[model samples]
Target: MNFFSKETKTALQAKEAALQLAFAPVAFQATRALRNLGILKIISDAGRAGISLEDIVAQLTLSKYAVRVLLEAGLGIELLLVNDKKYTLSKMGYFIEYDELTRINMDFTQDICYRGMDHLEEALITGKPAGLRELGPWETIYPGLSLLPPDIGKSWFDFDHYYSDIAYPQVLPVVFASKPRQLLELGGNTGKWALACTGYDPDVQVTILDLPGQMGIATQKIKAAGLEHRVSFFTTDVLNENLPFPDGKFDAIWMSQFLDCFSEAQIIAILQRCMASLADGGRIYILEPFWDRQVFKSAAYCLQQTSLYFTAMANGNSQMYHSDDLIACITAAGLTVISQNDQMGMSYTLLQCVIK
Candidate 1:
């Protein structure tokens, strides 16, 4: 069942894969152009009848050459099928054009990662987010997340929230199984989870611990929700080892897609802090899309590729971790993974841990 344990392609097939990689960027841009320029929509609207390059050009007010080149590239990318000088949308094209998940991933890639990815090699060499400079003057993306251009910021948050949002409803019951009165949510971006927690249980008091900028955004949402009395904010750089977590005994500490944003050592340090802050019988829950635990190969592939984005654009020291590696971090921090539930909403793994 190990999909990647052995080579399945013939030599010629492997060579073709190599060539695809060589021109992958060109293919990506061409596909984006086809979608953005309305070519894919026109062909999709044409249904089985398909649409001709001439018709596409006429409808879009683009030059014949421009439409033709992109349509031809679309053909090469297997996103289109041409017959009798007319183009039809392939299954892949349909997904690219209309699928919500695909749309979010495409927008995220284009708006947030495409240009910054050029510095990936430098980031690997320097152990720093060299590509982050493409976005703004920040050592890491977290601090500048709120300051990103509106469109870019939208794509980033959309990408971040899409996976976690799918898992929130499922995780709520798991976290509240103990009916804990106090919950601490780390990396509480925009306060979405905080809102979910407060809404799920009116009696549960939630504290969102995050950086100031993220706290600002979350604070607004908390106030707007009129849950200001039930929800509180704690702003600090989590990586500042000197500044330990605020003095409080939290009944449950929740980190959703948060630990993966830090290096292995940082994860251990953060987990240690969580241990220190836990009340009697308190537990820590970590929800992440650990690549190694994904049920589908496609999900694993997507997670693996997302790690590159972390290297180039997020914090270079962090990645979408393997399950084993992450578990090791927990053990190293003097915690025991009492329960691990995999295949949760959208290929995520929920690890329930207790102090050792």
Candidate 2:
């Protein structure tokens, strides 16, 4: 509040940042482990039963004392309750069950980030991933991803594909005035966005382009959506493969969460390819995370650092870019920025560019 003077505000912000710096990692690990324990209990109880401490010990293969400690801590955190020698999820814990956002966050922390955090020191030193330094990075992570059964990592992509699809109805009108045929959805997993877009415009032909494994999933999803007639899937490494389509083959291109994965040069290259592949004045819409200069010192900075750290660990490279950076990339690739809007109020920017 303005009632707090500027000096007080600055001091409070610094204090809060210090607290976050100290508490976030510990709290993150604790909550994630607790949530996993709760889920384990839920599943063990036929999905409708409460679990006793003994059950937790058996499921987690922990000593009785350790189980008690976990349960006590969990109860204190409101993830669990102590009642009649049994533990049950609290109402707040229901967010883990009922909210996709909560589940995705838990998954991200547990499956990807926790281990990556173990390598944070090495990452900071080399500006590369310690996990990759030891494990060969992208190659190891991607191929083994499908092999791992349905947990957070596998489910994350589903949410990614699904929520991006969910976002389309709201984003389309702002991004597109009239429908265009021949849509290319860059890095679209399982063709969700293509399906949504083609659903809105029956005449639109859609191609979903992504990595081979991702395209495999997209193919099945697109086929199941009954848009097979209008939609097709293409498995191509956008960075390595030559732009397969002829110049001006696409009327519109959609790249959601695609640019954030690349280095700056690669971003420029991809934008150039989009420019060449698009029809005259054809629009390209990009939805990617943003970290403007104004946000460089805000809580967004912490979020961005965490995102960057995980991305680097998982893939050896990732960057949170600003709208201006994107605009410059678009212009460098012979495209002009039409307009940009922050979607969902700064979660991401809906950026539109056209061939110059």
Candidate 3:
């Protein structure tokens, strides 16, 4: 069944939804302020009895006016419930305060994507990442990733790794089941998966193909993990179709949360290259969170919103894809999906393919 086949809201509900959309930014900032200012924690600690605005103000250095304004906003945002002049954390507030995923997503949106998102309209018109100027001078964000401010870089990688890392344990067994000794990982950011693969199979030799800056970080991580000998690095821009991939056949190729970083054309080009590099009978594993394949509407909503980030900040092209669109790219690249595993971790779908 189509997840959004029918309208579920009534006229009043639809109007309220429209109002929520209009005030989304205000609610977002208010919620973030409540969490960051430790107000949510104070209310949570107060337990079932809740606490008064005066008590909340007494616990923090913020003025009563400041605390009161945010608490009122929080009430409207549904992050807090107030009764008899007391405030208590709501279920939504709990997630905002303590959920790791929520924290990571919020931080990433604030630090990396917020300012640049202002240029989204311009980027859409120009077909370029106009908002990237907020960070550094680059056509796209990839080359400047390593050079990002420490806090920004941390948020970026935290968001990137969180989704993929959760699926590693479940996917490792699937990829290693065939016992591919010569494994190649495209866009092997920070060597996380390479490390996992080497640790999983002692005899396996892995190669990481990525841009030079990412290669540096991955190289350091591999060496720090004492797996340098088992892991090799191939530093080059994978988007540059003029440059050929390393001349070698692999038993299996793995790309985790990688292909979504490219546009449809680029994905097809990269896959075609992978097709050329695949050994006879070798398999290619692609792990992605296709929005349409999501089990929940919320997951699909998040993926769809992330596409705008690509428009304004990351690159003016690539996006979190729908499954059918991605599969079309696969077929265009002359490869066929032999197996597909959904709901691996979070919202990810792992596609196991072979040359057509």
- TM-score for all models, in order of appearance: 0.98, 0.75, 0.98
Q: What tens digits encode model 1's per-residue C-alpha lDDT throughout 152-270?
A: 99999999999989988899999999999999999999899999998899799998999988888888898998999999988888999888796758999999999999999999999
lDDT of each: 0.91, 0.65, 0.91
Candidate 3 C-alpha lDDT tens digits along 1-356: 26778999999999999999999988888888999989999999999999999999999999999999999999888999988988898899999998998999999898888899889999999989889899899998989989999999999999999998999999999999998989989998888999899888999999999998778788889889998789998877888888888775899999998998898999999999987777789999999998888888987888899898899998899899999999999999999999899969997999999988
Candidate of highest lDDT: 1
Worst 10 residues of 1 by lDDT: 240-249
- Residue-by-residue lDDT tens digits, candidate 2, 104-154: 656665665566667767665765666644333354245444444566456
Q: Which ten residues in a row have the lowest lDDT in candidate 2?
A: 1-10
Q: For all candidates, what are the clash counts? A: 0, 1, 0
Please list the residue runs of candidate 3 whose C-alpha ends up more than 4 Å from where it truly belongs after superposition.
none
How far out, in Å, is residue 335 in model 3? 0.3
Task: Indicate whether candidate 2 or candidate 3 has the larger TM-score.
Answer: 3
State each model's C-alpha RMSD to the native: 0.9, 5.5, 1.0
